[model samples]
Target: MIFGNPGITYAATVEVEAESAILVDAETGKILFEKEADLTLPPASMTKMMTEYLVLEAIEEGEISWDTTTQISDYPYSISADPSFSGVGLTQNQDYTVRELYEAMAINSDNATTIALAELIAGSEGAFVKMMNKKAAELGLPDYQFVNSTGLSNSNLGENYPEGTEPNANNLLSARSAALLAYHLVNDYPEALEITSITTTEFDGQQIRNWNWMLPNMPGYLADYGYEGMDGLKTGWTDLAGYCFTGTAERDGQRFISVVMKTNSEEARFQETRKLLDYGFKQFEQKELFPAGYQIEGESEVPVAKGKEGTVEIEAAEDLTTPVKNGQEDMYEVKYNISKEHLDKDGNLTAPIKKGEKIGTVELVYNGEDNYKNLVTGKTQKTAVDLVTTSAVEKSNWFMLMVGGVGNFFSDIFTSAMDMVKGWF
Candidate 1:
């Protein structure tokens, strides 16, 4: 049933009511879908995923520990006490473990706790934001910017503003870039999901609820909207940002990361995300295009002009497996393009060929246009591999070359006589 020319027929027309949205395969970094995904927009609480990532990185670096405790500063304490802000309420001067703070920040989307974790890692919220930006650069996220550990727009802080804080300050990320962030978070810190996935937990004996309702255990939404295998990431909302969620899910061994930003309501963000995820899961599949060391049965050998054996066998250096939609695996044709550098004007290799030299590329292409009606974009489904010599090929010695020439002359005559005999028969 494998076919090409991917169509959206199997996909339900999902109208995503969001400023930007993107779905990505976390493992392979393949973008499944996107809408206005490059537009810069408020990240909202989804910014906490980066904060959590940095915290986990620090923990892995042995710079911090789950059991390590830090005293609550006035900023975090005041933010926690402010009814307008989301927080795990903390008394001033109270010490809390890194683990508890992480729970508050990730599960509950507590601004104060997020700030605390940021400060603990970077000595100041601003410094931690710098680190966030640095990490974003390292991850190849070109358009992401973080102003604070929490995604709160500065306008929401009211009269309790910090001295040097700017109004309307907030983190920003494109939907595609946000998906990349989530990709790194899950791939690098599988343990962080344990904390982010918690729908309810007690901190200081108070039951805190996670804001991400898409989780299967999120109580009221479980039977309806709760997606199985939906674990973590973060959710966010502000008057300007509306409702945003960066969600990750795993099913049947495949993991997907989805980002929905600036939806009209909390429900729409999750619901639309579910549709996108469904389309991605149904329409695409992972398939191997080529296996390592695979040699074409009848076409394995390339003529070598000066080699001892007069020819050499080649193979692909490695395997290539990518997510292909519309059963492209069967319909897509494999083309091996041998490089001119490996051949002379007569179309035969002039050897002294090294064992592992690059000599060709393999490409996968469909016959017709893709879903977008584009020509399926050449080089999108291609990989250049070293066409290694299975055995080293050296130039023939003078006597060997003379003998080979004589042998080839007789061999050609004998082949002609056999062909004539076959023709008569």
Candidate 2:
């Protein structure tokens, strides 16, 4: 798609063959391009990202080890009809190691593998869903609700009722949630990449390939413009949702992710991600515009009361730079919005305020519009306040006294004495 006088958001206009998309800069966590990104669309096997996330988290906590082996319980297996599932065709009694199961899930997008991993780590898929939901909430992906380890619907498994008519614990997730899940997977679980980065693998004398068709294809039949460093991930198809893909790639040190759902065909899903990823990587370049410790040049002076220190120094959090293309830097500028609310009327120490405190934020503007470039990044830096001794306030410290400090302490003593004298009351 082409940019036609786009405004602050620079929102993409391209409608992919997929249902919705969210393309984010992996390194900076910036939304490079999006189409119906917030719209929750069903994610098929990509839901495995959550299953994958839970397994990795367990591994990190030392709750489970790669060498750990587990039983092929019918629980996670019944959710899949595909033979690649780790729990399926389980040699009917063989035990798979924790690491092996994770490999199955991440490298092969094996539904049964995911469930077996979850169960081995957390006792059961039901229990693991607790961990999954808890982790997603912690990561602030409130839009997602995981129902199971595999993306199978409980109702769909009725035909295979290995354990009888009871429903199987299937799973569900949205495209954006899955993208965040992938984001966490790539960034949080470095070990996972060891598997996802692999294009192909074989398990138990069975040759199974990665469902993520991005590798070995050179951005393959997807787009006229291709992305570089495209890695492995998951893909899914069902009668309800056409085809879905969740992919990640990197270029010039800037990593990005693309999530597409409900495409008309498997090829279409791949094509759309290629287009989004290509446009994203080619358009924006990462820049470390500001260092967190950078001390800004100037500060506006304010009134101050008598104190040991005549002036308190306040500095900007960092020097500022932004992500932009060639020749577009100077067109936009940032404005500081620090407020003097923390300062007293006399402009003296207010109980030793800390430096680098959230004194305020800065906003960036372009062409008379809020470029929304403030980035709203999380706490940039910690303030190392130089609490220099300053002269005491000349007037009565009523504020502190009111809070009943030393003065209150004495007043209470006096009051106690008076009450003693009137003890009868």
Candidate 3:
């Protein structure tokens, strides 16, 4: 049976200053707010989050180790020598450990170090770009295109653009896509935060600071933008991409991931992100709309055919809990879907149903105006719980089954005869 609640208030809305922006619950990937979130734009340095994910995955899979070292190729060496790009100077054919390069890339947004790590892992940057695109598809990112490891336009790489890519190409992602990438990075390899959270770390005896000023421990002038509960995330900018950031923070057992793209200035990215995160933390609360074993009133039972009992009761197999907007409890409703495979032709469950037997599922649907899609799957966020039988229903004995069959046969015959007589009249 279908049931619904009445009266839904519009979800509160907040304005953010950016071309594209999104906020999501880090744990559930449920989008809390979005504006032009699907508009594809250059991600700049935020592209490295994908690189970071692949590196951590390689390490976890035993393909490489933190101590693994690779020599600097001439391509990366030339890029490192240019001060215009973010990099640490590298000597030709000199060795550097994965740990060192990874820290520089994550903390300082070092383009050359990022490319070097990509080459080390995939034997070449071109191969690494392939891995990035493949992994994005695997992760269900809605919109993305990876042309280089550093998020730089291939024009910046000059003659060294990765093979099979356009020289004018730059990495692109929608805000939703960027948030999804960050979601997987943090959840899959949380250890990455250890390096990204560092405000400043010495690399080759030179101090390099993280680009994300929202981190809690910024020193000097950057301290002005510090935000509590903020941690390691990537920041980005280019002539084409404007300023962008993928930021994540945790407080009071809640974590939010935010992305702001094409903001006007270096500080605007963080400021816009602050708006997104604040809206999430201040306006929503963890709510259990329904508890486990919950059953809808007047619609909790399913008929059982040829069983000792006439019907079987069903209830939710697990709890339905998620972040809900404050004072918007009535905006949500539950829907039950019975499994056709478990029901007979007459819509009755077969005999001998076991207790807690898998039968159907109940899903939560949002009726408010600000309903949003999942960050990863790009589908409407409908959380579902399994429905199972509350108790077993034993099959009737042979005598009872025969009696029921006889009753059904006589009833059908009587109905047909009545219809025939009416037709003759």
Candidate closest to the true structure, highest TM-score: 3
Tens digit of per-residue lDDT, candidate 2, span 1-425 = 11223233434335566668777666556665566665665676777777777777777788877788877866555554455343334443788787767777777677677767777777766677777778878776736756665665655545442232246444455656677777778888756666787765677777666667776543334333333587757777666656888888876677778888888887788888888777776667766444444333554332334332345554445544445543344444344455567556654445434344455554443442222211113222111222122223233355744554667688899999999989978
- Angstrom error of the Cα, residue 217, model 3: value is 1.9
- Candidate 1 has its poorest 10 consecutive residues by lDDT at 371-380
What value does the lDDT take at residue 211 in candidate 3? 88
Per-residue alpha-carbon lDDT of model 3 for 1-425, expressed as tens digits? 22344454554678999999999999888999989999999999999999999999999999999999988888998899998984778777667899999999999999989999999999899999999999999999989999999999999999999997999998999998999999999999999998999999998789988889999869988999998899969999999999999999999888899999999999899999888888999898778888999898888999999899999999999988788887677777787899999999999999899999989898887776665677766778879999999999999999999999999999999999999999999
Ranking by lDDT: 3, 1, 2
Kindly report the root-mean-square deviation of model 2 from the true structure over all alpha carbons.
Answer: 9.9
RMSD of each: 6.7, 9.9, 2.4
Can you give the TM-score per candidate against the true fold? 0.81, 0.72, 0.93
TM-score for candidate 1, residues paired by index: 0.81
Flag clash pairs in model 3: none
- For candidate 1, give the lDDT: 0.78
By the lDDT metric, which is better: model 1 or model 2?
Answer: 1
**Model 2 residue 387 CA deviation in Å:** 15
Q: Give the candidate order by descending TM-score.
A: 3, 1, 2
User: Candidate 2, residue 39: CA error in Å?
Assistant: 2.9
